[model samples]
Target: MNKIIEIVSSLDTNQVYAELSHPNSGGICVFFGAVREFTNNEQVTGLEFETYEAMALKEMNKLADTALEKWGLNKVVIKHAIGKKEVQEPVVVVGASSAHRSACFEACRFLIDTLKETIPIWKKEIFKNKSVWVSAHP
Candidate 1:
């Protein structure tokens, strides 16, 4: 397959390079979304992610297909981690490989942005005393 779409409990960057590498591609672009230490000046202890698994997978597959066709990508990988994650832990990873740098660069951005806007995944920010479920967009 030209694409890999999955919702995982953990994200492994080591596998990303192999997954996005293609002989026809000159460049691969990757974006890793991680749990940050702070949000809105509040210290974030960690994060919890939840998703409608069936729908999230469907949307992710659609994104990979669209990116492949639109950018002529040789390979695509989209993954998101569920459950709890500590600060600095990767929450999601998206990548694309194309014949040149431009296509992969733009496709990588599109894949992540569109996924955040449309996918059924939700995130909760954990603080010292309380937790808040955050919207997909700010």
Candidate 2:
């Protein structure tokens, strides 16, 4: 079975790992995208992520389904956090399981790459002296 998708204020790596664990799954690929302290040397302080939740969720699920079909994977889980996030905090996590390592890795990478390009989300960057809005997937 597929795992849940949560949009929360925070995420725990261990908890996410445990949720994706499966007895028949021989390989698991995990990806964590954290809030960076600097973007183009702008000295970022924090970021606020906003999404059209319904549309974003639909796209994310479509990404997972495509990956599963292409890779013949056992399961896939994608979780993203919204709202204000501090530097170094995880913003997104993706996990994929398969019977082999190659498929797992490929699917995981595809999931994240596609998500960053296709998801409809926006991020407001708060810098030390200025702030700006940018494409979340960019």
Candidate 3:
């Protein structure tokens, strides 16, 4: 019954996973998104993430509520990093738990996909000499 909607400097994957564990849930799905070294075949050094923290968290919570209601999910946790992130560093973590595996998988997928599309977060692709502001929604 707990909803995890947070924006932090770093994402704690283990902690989010722990929060998703529930006796009523038989299946759990987790997703981790890391800063990649390449984008559209362009070499990348790192990434910088920024957000309207209050608005973003509110939107994230709404998504969690939607998932819970639609999928009968027992737990939904979404953690996003707001700051500079190096390559391979986790930027976002989403965990969903449901009584059935199908619901778990669908809810987890929906959480990540909907997050990227609807969240009010912005990102910058950091290159060797320049950085460009990018849209969080892909």
Best by lDDT: 1
lDDT of 1 by residue, 82-105 (tens): 999999999999999999999999
lDDT of each: 0.94, 0.85, 0.90
Model 3 stretches with alpha carbons more than 4 Å out:
136-138
lDDT of 3 at 87: 97
- Clash tally, candidates in order: 0, 0, 0
**What TM-score quantifies how close candidate 1 is to the native fold?**
0.97
Candidate 2 lDDT, 1-138, residue by residue in tens: 674666666777787667767787789999999989989977999988988999998888888888889998878888888899999999999989888889999989998898889988778999978778985256
Ranking by TM-score: 1, 3, 2
Top-TM-score structure, candidate number = 1
Tell me the TM-score of each prediction against the true structure. Answer: 0.97, 0.91, 0.94
Residue 103's lDDT within candidate 3 is: 95
lDDT of 3 by residue, 41-127 (tens): 888999999899889989999999999999988999999999999999999998899888999999999999999999989889999
Total clashing pairs in model 1: 0
At residue 37, candidate 2 shows an lDDT of 94
Of the candidates numbered 1 and 3, which has the greater lDDT value?
1
Worst 10 residues of 2 by lDDT: 1-10
Q: lDDT of candidate 3? A: 0.90
